[model samples]
Target: MKSEFQSHEPDEPFLSRVQRVLTDLSPAERRLGEFLLDFPGELGSYDAQELARLCDVSKATVSRFIRRIGFESYDKAKKAVRDERATGSRAFFAHAEPEANAAALALDMREEKDNLDRTFGKLNAGELDDLARAVLSSRKVWIAGQRISFSFAHYLFWQLTKIVPEVVVFPQGGETLGEHVARIQKGDLVIAIMLRRRVAGTKRLLDAILEAGAELALISDESMARHADARWHFHCHTHSDGPQFNHAAVLALCHQIVVRATLQSGREGRERLRAVDAVNEKLLQVEW
Candidate 1:
């Protein structure tokens, strides 16, 4: 009988190729792929030792598996996986026609609502209040995110600036991340947003912030929660519409945080609004 686990043909579908390669893999390689397929979110965040421990394999086995998958090292394999996920996510969303994808989007929306409900049920009021107070009192606030997460960070930065004196959104991929992090004082707060597929640069920034002794407010999926050293952490549950792409639930969480912050700032926020209106009124009189 012909082997069912043949090398993938050039024209083969991605999922089919994945399945074929998985079937052809040695037992150890198969275990590793199974681990990745079963918990892509978890595997995305795990180190080699952690992955090996979870998969009940040795570190050498993990290394061998990585090499078998055509990556020279574990880090390279992880990076490949991340890139594949990002590309797959973008492709899925790009191909989706609003009318044709409506049912799928609706399903996603419903799932997001259920996640929000569960999160609210489990949220600690006192912790939220403390986080709000920290935001209100911090001398400076730094918001950082990459890719899809950049939108969430930008939204929070905008809202926080309305009520707070100093707020900055860290730009995407600069050579000066370390220098920027160096400027954070003890009273500063860093709000970092990352999701299932956390960006490497974002993680590096988070680490730098921790070393600088800045307080952290982390908003991420549950799988990435361990990576952040947050004084307060909010886990946004997201379900994958395909093999990749998970952002809707995170955007909802961002909205929730901004709304909560606005409510907590009340009078201060109103006063700032008045100030902004006055500035806008004067600025509107001038034409470009």
Candidate 2:
């Protein structure tokens, strides 16, 4: 049986599905669905009565639309849209410093917590497990990131190395980027980390990896939906910080990926860790 999620393609004709599912809805619910389909971007600013007026329906009809779409009430529907907007806005402002006022700091903290909660709630266990398995099975894994994302790429490289010796972190910048990108081959997995204000270098690297026939996975903000052309993509919320730089949430996400990969890799993962331990001990003994 096809899951409801699987049955609904993102690019499907919107009106067809709306008409099919909302056929039994009262005139008001149909109006609300039509309004959403027609002006989705405007939903963030809509109140119950405002939405109803725009849809040529009563506020009560708008409320029914909420339940029809699986939400309990108009407020719940509105909150979902607001949360999505907040997540996108936060990503754009991530890296900015908190304001000096105590109230501002408190607000920032609240937003961050909400962002994290939303992010966690959206995680798909099945998708995560599949990603882990793919990484473990790949003959080689190349992690690429430029600028703010470089730290996340490096972190994944370090953790993955403990379990998968063939992992490589692309050099920050220089001819090495070109050389490493050229080396990507079939059966390799290229994990790219990119976010708001995407780096040109990262985009170029992703293109190269794609041209080389390597499987690609992307870690980025939800606002970057268009930029990510990977076979698999994960969005991690990093809002609530200042606009200059922020990678706390991204780092946490990378950690989860690595830890899950380790667990899924089974006995081979254990032996790989033991080998890494030996190498680390040897390096310590040889320190200058």
Candidate 3:
């Protein structure tokens, strides 16, 4: 049928490909495409017959839509969408309409649950162990995150500094980020939290960290998957149930990282914790 989807470059985003074919599709096909376009995540959950019923289109139109999108069959189209979706691509989040009242909370819970499942499912055990080892052995661990992500970075930094010596968080008060980058030694590790609406200059900052001979680690949402330089890349899912984005998955992932690092620290970690407790007691940091 010489559909517009056929002209897409191999690397182009599937969402963009769908958009390109929007005007070329018949009325029924366009309706189905638009529905899937708005609820791209649903593509993973619905079969052709079910989707046809939901979109008020016939089975033939569903089959035609699959081919129009450059897939050989309905199953293949669904698989492609699911694969792209698993990456936590921004397209799925872009058009996810906000809900109201109790529906919003219900949706939030559902989406957050899915986030944890998908994120933990994809995590590699060996890679996690390697990150823990890096934390325990590095001369200094430099952590950086801006905006909302800074909260996660701060929590991780707070936990890590108590267990490991020489942990630094960048842009402390009057100091600049570049100053911190300059302090990174060859054996140091840099953990960066870069989620959606990525901070300007983040890639450049990571580059600077790498150029300074420090190993780079990334804790980010699927949108940042293309970052090839990270020694360890942990991608989390951040789908929100409402108008705002959800961060529960990111927090859970960070918690796991801290737990692993603590376990890897072994006797040294226990000694450090005891020392911290002694100081806390003397300083009356925690009220009884």
- Clashing residue pairs in candidate 1 are none
Candidates by TM-score, descending order: 3, 1, 2
Candidate 1: stretches off by over 4 Å: 1-108, 172-175, 242-246, 285-288
lDDT of 3 at 53: 83
Q: Write the per-residue lDDT of candidate 3 for residues 1-288, one digit (tens) a residue.
A: 653445556556667767878888889999988988777766666788877887889999988877777777778767777778655454554333344335665733788888899899999989988998999999989888887777888999999998989997777667778777777879999898998777678778888888999998899887665578788999898876444677888999888889999998999899999999999999999876
| Clash list (residue pairs), candidate 2 | 95-242, 95-245, 96-242, 96-243, 97-242
- Give per-residue lDDT, candidate 1, residue 88: 40
| Order by lDDT, highest first | 3, 2, 1
lDDT of each: 0.68, 0.69, 0.80
Candidates 1 and 2, the one with greater TM-score:
1
What lDDT does candidate 2 reach at residue 110? 67
RMSD to native for every prediction?
A: 11.2, 14.4, 7.5
Q: Provide the TM-score for each candidate, comma-separated.
A: 0.62, 0.60, 0.66
- Candidate closest to the true structure, highest TM-score: 3
Cα shift from native, residue 49, model 3 (Å):
27
